[model samples]
Target: MSTPVTASADALHRAATRKAMLRLIPLMCLIYLLSYLDRTNVSIAKSQLAIDLGLSAAAYGFGAGIFFLSYALLEVPSNLAAHRFGPRRWIVRIAITWGALSAAMMFVRGETSFYVMRMLLGAAEAGLFPALMYMITLWFAQEDRSIAVGWVYTAPALALLIGNPVGGALMQLDGSFGLHGWQWMFLAEGVPSILVGVLLWFKLPERPHDARWLSKQEADLLTARAVSSGTGGGHDASRITLAMLKQALLKPFVTLIGAIYFFNQIAFIGLIFFTPAIVQQMHVKTPLLVGALSSAIGVGSVIGVLGVPRIQRWLQRDCLLLGLLTFGLIAGSVLFLLVPTLVVRIALLAILAFFGKGVLTLYWTIAMGRMQGFGAAAGLAFINMLGLIGAFVGPYAYGLAESATGKASSGFFVAILASVLGLVLVPLLPAALRRADAEASQSQRTSARVMTADSPVV
Candidate 1:
């Protein structure tokens, strides 16, 4: 069915796509790596910082979790604003300001200052994920976005893999310049974001049309693909209203996906926030030793992040991916709960990270399937904002449990319970997405009829 000219054009299209991905993805991945590291490096600092700052278990947990409270509150508005202004300016602002706040964390003398800084940090970083994804839509066609996102989501896995050891090493910098090692870590890690933010102002492009790196032929192909892929509901960025955003959030499909995200993130956040201390309790005293042990989760997660997309394609069904992730979560939880030994617990934690991160990473694919334009963009922000509420609740609850029991085991059980809850929610998605698609179709037809009625006869 293909002629020589058509085949040549197809080959050219593939080459351009590859080139665009190579040029754009590395910097983006680095940015996302910093985002995760800046937020979660506190995990490595947990024990030392708590002692240095005289914070109780509960107070520390609340401060750590408070970041998500502000994140949830501002995520939707921030994402919408980023959509309006363009990713180049908005993402840069987010990075630099968040970096400043993260660097300012060295000033925490007590709980009040700690809480204030964490809140400020959350406010600064809100909508970062959605804004980045919005930029992906501008740069890559829809069909290619999954692969692009798959690569980008690797940042968190790599952050954990690299950040844990580096943060551990930084934790050893205790007498340098009269600052605590944790303080050194904060200042050192925070500078990269500031540097990268400045670079983004010049390096990042707002749209494909604006990318000087893209050739004319390549740009023409991307333009055609972008228009075709955007035919559903994505093209008109300006017409996005508050009502549409509200509707998108309230939709049953969004709610269903939100529920799955909520439960998984509770376990994910709680585990990441508390794991360093938990591993330290297993006779691992030094920061580097504890960090290396805890990095098992990261190892499993990287494998899951890189391999799950191919697995999903092989399985050829969305439901299978959801089901597999749910099973992994439940199984990992139950195994860890049953075995009280340290080695088994560590292994089980890897299993949890593998499935949990994979599920969380790939879920956007299903959620974004029916979404096209402004509504989809805002909807993603709202859903992620909703998920952050769970992140806030999970760590706070685990900290309370740990505080009450005076043991890390109790806090870990809370994570297991959160994972168990996913079984109930994962089965609800296929039907909800279908119903949402049907409603969207009906609304489009209704709009067409109204427009026809308003038009003059030819």
Candidate 2:
């Protein structure tokens, strides 16, 4: 009777743990979806905003791209703060602020107002991804980290998949409630993030210890698993000084990861910011259809994100990256050179989205595996800072090139260059990090063997 009861209780506990993770996924997805939507809505709004504000293509591109400049500068400090204060408090705060700023776009009139609001939005959102990464470090073991990271990443794809169509519909809602279509788009998209922030404050547990849904035993097991996997212990809460920052900046693996992230962003942000316009160039005048097609890239991203963990395990990290980078380069090249049909171009874009996002998953997984010590958080923050710089530069660079060449194909050529750079850089990272990982695994095995030999049998 006692054994049966114990088994039943164990099953109940397991169910509860599963329930907690399940509850957390949608909320996480929602947060990421909104973040991407808010960040890229400016791209969707570019057509109408450009005409209404009397801005040139370059001016509109600059306005759209400048958000990441402030975002890049503030990322490290904001993430460090999340590390020190705990994610629950800081994430909610950042989300709410960014959400309000996003909605505030409705009030912008001229170029100055647009630029100011964009910068404000960037500053407000600086903490979100870094904080999410830090939170994952706390809650998940290393083995589980990539899949978890992939899920959060799936948001960008989903956002791209959904945002354009939604933005188009809302934009068409102009004159409803005394708002322009663009204003309506901003308001509809931005308001939900604030509400999500409030909900996150209530639903997100600060740590395993605070998760009421988990039994004490289950939490201990989870933490122990994390510690055993080479994370979740000795996370120093000391503020990062200039010297510490320099050390993080100087690490070979960190710098390599940043380069990979930067190059990847160059391709990604370029495509995202310009996709609607690209479709427009293909003679697709229907903004709603363009939006839906653009969103399909996100759908491709979902498949990539879900599929990458298995692919990583099979090919190993570096190999997986090389393959994906190759795929992106080839797909991008074909899209640039061969495909002229709108349907074919859209299909190719979806393929690019699939492979491009897959490459990113591999890059991030490798970075997390190599990132060690208290400075790991800072390393990630700095990577993001550099990556956002690429994000800022990529779109604007493409727009400027378009302005000069009077053709969109110039942007695709730039993307091919970035993708090739990623292919070259990814191969170099394994010698620096993979060798260390191998040595560490050997050391751990030797330690375990000695300990096993010395243990007395009961």
**Which clashing pairs does model 2 show?**
157-298, 160-295, 161-295
Pairs with steric clashes in candidate 1: 233-373, 234-372, 234-373
Tell me the lDDT of model 1 at 10.
74
| Cα lDDT, all candidates | 0.81, 0.78
- Look at candidate 1 and tell me the lDDT of residue 447: 88
lDDT of 1 by residue, 272-316 (tens): 888887788778899988888888788877877877777777776
Q: Look at candidate 1 and tell me the lDDT of residue 98.
A: 93
Q: Evaluated with lDDT, which candidate comes out highest?
A: 1
Model 2 lDDT per residue over 12-63, tens place: 5455445545766677878988999999998777778878887666777777
Give each model a TM-score: 0.93, 0.90
Could you tell me the lDDT of residue 457 within candidate 1?
A: 94
